[model samples]
Target: MHISAREREIINLLLDHPDGINVQEIAESLNVSSRTVQRELKGVESIASAHSLFLKKVLGVGMYIEGTPEQKNELQIAILKSGQEFTQKERQELILCSLLKEPESIKLSSLANDLHVTVATVSNDLNKVEEWLKDFDLNLIRKKGYGIALLGSERKKRKALGHLIAQQLNEYEFLSVVEDEYESKTRFSNGLLEIIKLEKLTMIGKMIRDIEQQLPYSLADSAFMTFTIHLSLAIERIIQGEVIQIDQEVLEELSISKEFIIASQIVIELEEVFQVNIPIAEKGYITMHLLGARQRQEKNDWQKESSTEMVVGSKKLINYVSKELEINFEEDQALFEGLITHIEPAIYRIQKKLDANNPLAGQIQEDYPAMFKIIQEGLSEAFPKIVFPTEEIAYLVLHFGSSQVIYDNSKEVRALVLCSSGIGSSKMLASRIKKEIKEITEIEVSSLANLRNIQIDQYDIILSTVEMPGFSKKYITVNPLLPKKEAEQIRDEIKRNSLTTEATLLRKLHNKKFKKQIKLKTPKLIKQNLEVIQQYTETVLHILNTFETISLPFIPTSSILLLEVCKQANVRGLIGDYFEVTNQLTEREKKGGLGIPGTSIALYHCRSEYVMQPVFLSFLLHEPMVVKAMDHSSIKINTLLLLLAPVDMQTGQLEVLSTISSTIIDDEESTRIFTSNNYTDIYSKLSYALYDNLQKRFKD
Candidate 1:
């Protein structure tokens, strides 16, 4: 009962065309097999009979509903009374039966493969088909390895076919209309041969005789013959439940019809039947044949227009022309505008020249050498040109080039800044003004005392900390001594000059920041950052350890001593020295009036490794130390110690200091381990935690 989407599509296509579709055609349309179409139809038959619907088959034409006209009428009335309640698949199957003139038996294997199902399923469908036809003394006749056929009395078959036809007419009125149109068109044609090809040879002879009587002069011309062949092929495909693609243009041209209404109608019908929209142009020239109004081919004449008249000026016009010619153009504003203005008139003039009757007009190289050169240059610059009428050329040029002219409506002003001395103060003021007030019209800063020496007409607003003589009162004045509030006031004035300028700039800035943030978060960017940091640190470490001994800065008198402790044991020489300095610094720093004791200081040489790798160390003070000089009371003596090492170090003693800093600054457990003298244990614990944190944060 539940049909797949593919089965539904196939059923719809079949239902679209009445009079019976061939099994092979159905297979082809559904991209399966004739056998598959048969099996699916059988399944449909079962479902229908289960619901008291009749399915019947014709001897040669195809299958239909088996019932008398009155019975068919009754079925139709019942279906209407029931409001046509059916699933999409059921509806599709009904439609197919209505469209098809004949339904044929096909092999179960072929059907199974086409439907992508097991042969057992096909057998089950056959059983249902037999059950559906039981009331009419009809049943599915299976031949070994051949296929299954409907076996029933001719009267029963006719009645069933009538029932199907009536039902189809009720559901889709368009099917009858389409068939009528097709019959009208092919009534006198020999194309019926194509439709009868799949039938038995004995039937073909009878069909030929019937065709001859009906269409005596249909084969008189090759066009009619071709139409017959194609139409018959199409009918055969439809009967077989296959979707067919007929060349719309070819059909129209072959028929010698100027209008393609018939072809369009066919497309619409097919679309409705199959529920698939085919990609095709709505309008196009059919080149298969030349007939009537289409017989006259326009000649491409070059000497009909003036050169200048052909020029295109406007970007919009250029774009229109380019689109017509399927060409690409640059989308930049300035370049496009310039191209439109400068080239439009020239093209128009050229068009005019080309349109002249004189033969010389077409010879651009001889008659208008300069114009020809310009065209060549434009072509090289990727501009497109088409051989169109002079008027069209002129229009295109004007359209593409009209936007090039720049309009100036705002007043222009140049202002100068005056200060006592043109040094730090004046420079600072200029920088501040530039940064804050972007719209000052024009700006000039100078300490030159004589304002009358320069052109006074250019000056608008004079800003000076000192007094200036001979200044016009009409000009605005502001102090040169820059203050945040004064800068803000000037900014406000600039904002008033242009309402949207600041907002636009801010939007642009925000957009840029957003783009940068996106780039920063990319995996590639993070990897690159890590690589650069590692490289820089390694290089600095190499330099500091291998070369350069440097003296430390003299400790200032105001320096707060941090540590003072007796050296307990002899450590590694450099390490011992570092410890002594750190201990003393920690004691001295704690001695200040501020109450805190756990603080410690660490020192290292300046080197790449030390600088690149941050230093973190942790230790708990034995007794609480106080530094009264400091202010905050939240500071506690029992705390973690951290030290930042320089990029260059004289002694290699700072190596361990690097890892210590990295640890204590990040996780809490590092401080615990450092206080416990369990460096290795602390490293293990922190490393595991770090790995877990990174995995959780960075998993894809």
Candidate 2:
């Protein structure tokens, strides 16, 4: 029987979660109503029973699949074996490929025929495609004679094509005719081949090798492959009578630049090989790629005299990065010179162009997002000349990423930590130190009595919870659980070891503005303030007791779990008058993934008209829900933290909550609460963790 993609997805979801799920939960996950889930479940139950599986429903709980593991596998195989209907996502991909690769306008009927879908369905798919294209500054042009074509500058089209290709490049067939028994297994489609013949692509590859031999430059292996595809797409577009349009002034500037000179010579060879007239603008476009392209390190010119402007720019950028990351790099002369060499050519690349593609930009952003943002902001100050695309900034990140000293976790300081408490508190102390200090080459925890027999000269620094008499080493007292004061001591001691004892100017940037003390003059005014404080305290207590959080029993869709949480929020009076928090949550999730990258947790928060006071709710689940996060990646979320603030919450009030949440995500202490089953355990641990985080913020 034919089933919609959504139903198939729901069935698969149910299969993944053998434990029953509620209709309300399924509805939320599918972005449908509970009624819709019930209707679909009825249809799915028949399909399940046909495959010897059952969709069992409990009155108070939800629906679950009841079948043996072997039967479930069979059900999955059957589902996969059946010719599943075209999902909207797959249709969109097909639509994008056809528009980009095909030279002719794609008729609505033609697209529908290829996808085996109706014209209206194709139309709906295009609507989604059109919205997606807008992000790339591309437009879908639909007309009577010309059915539909992608309208944009050749540059943008190439970038869009590269992005699309990057996402689905694995799907294309790649052929290689390497001499004798070895060939490239990669594949490209006939449509892609039409854009640039396989021979032409091979030719461009050769041209780049020849160029590299002449110039003191070579692209990274990944960068070279990406460049070949980009050039091929450019050639394809040029052959189709579309030429790159560069601004007249930028063209004049680039024509005299070194990159443009090399591009012109390459274009000369290209014309002879392809028997096609290449545009000067196209040559200029190629020049931008050559300029921004990764340079080979074999040509070490750090000692070579750099212009004053380049050196100064490099220094500023490096300093900015060091300050933001809270790591010292100024002493690393090698890194300083390397930045100078990189910035010299990069400045030119930025000055002369708007777009320079870095194909690995997506992966880079995902891996070093924190570094990317810091460098992005740093470039703005250091260069101040041109706006840097996130792509260009990503290439620059390669230079910093290569430097090991900047992010090295092993602190140069060797020390022994002694605590009166047993291993548990001592272990917690070491963890806290590691989290805060980021320094400590070797830290061994020991009881004070054991230290009497140990040699003191072996260690340079000593951290003790109890007083140690006549210790030759520099001894510092610290907390057994968390060494808040001892962290500052560690930093100060580490700085003393450095040859030059200068500190970073931005070290104090963490400090928030101090609040003014509020003193009441009148007795009545004091009583009012006390009552207000008492009410909020009572409110928090009420929330904690009323909606401590239900550890989700099964893996449900994000929407389904969301409904369950919203029901609690409403019942507990967390929702404001005439407001349903779930409605705002559904709307917010549509904007992007609610989870942050590199973290397993997901956060759903908003300041809505539906909120009275800021309420923070943490939900635990037995299994991780496969949900889309802020980075547009699907991650298994075991814990869900919900933050609903007042519609007009004060900026400072919101920041306090945000800071507390960040601490929980950043440190493991509070994160344990998300997985905890005991209500008292969770409450005590979270409250204490929040207090510790606030204390650290004050210290900062």
* lDDT tens per residue, model 2, 1-700: 6666777768867875566666655665566665666667777888889988888887434688898877777776666556667567767877887887665687888888878899899988899999989978989998876699998766777777776654533212221321112132122333344455666666787777768777766675545555676777777777778777778886887788787888889888878877789988888778777766656475466545578877888889989987776667777787887777666666665564434545568767765555677789998898897677776788777777656554352235556777442222244456566667766656666655456766554454667654433343446655443435547756776755432111111111222111122232477756664564455445445445544665667745777788777776777787764236676677667654566445566777655677776676677877777887544568777777776666554433433444444444445655565545457866776566545644564464
Q: Which candidate leads the pack in TM-score?
A: 2
lDDT of each: 0.38, 0.64
Model 2: C-alpha RMSD to truth?
Answer: 17.5
RMSDs, each prediction?
31.4, 17.5
TM-score per candidate, chains pooled: 0.19, 0.46
> What is the RMSD of candidate 1?
31.4
Candidate 1 TM-score, true structure as reference: 0.19
For residues 266-321, write the lDDT of model 1, one tens digit per residue. 44554564455533332221112111111111212221321333333244444543
Alpha carbon lDDT at 247, candidate 2 = 81
> Which 10-residue window of candidate 2 scores lowest in summed lDDT?
500-509
Give stretches of model 2 more than 4 Å off: 1-90, 101-105, 142-147, 166-199, 245-265, 294-300, 303-305, 363-369, 396-402, 409-700
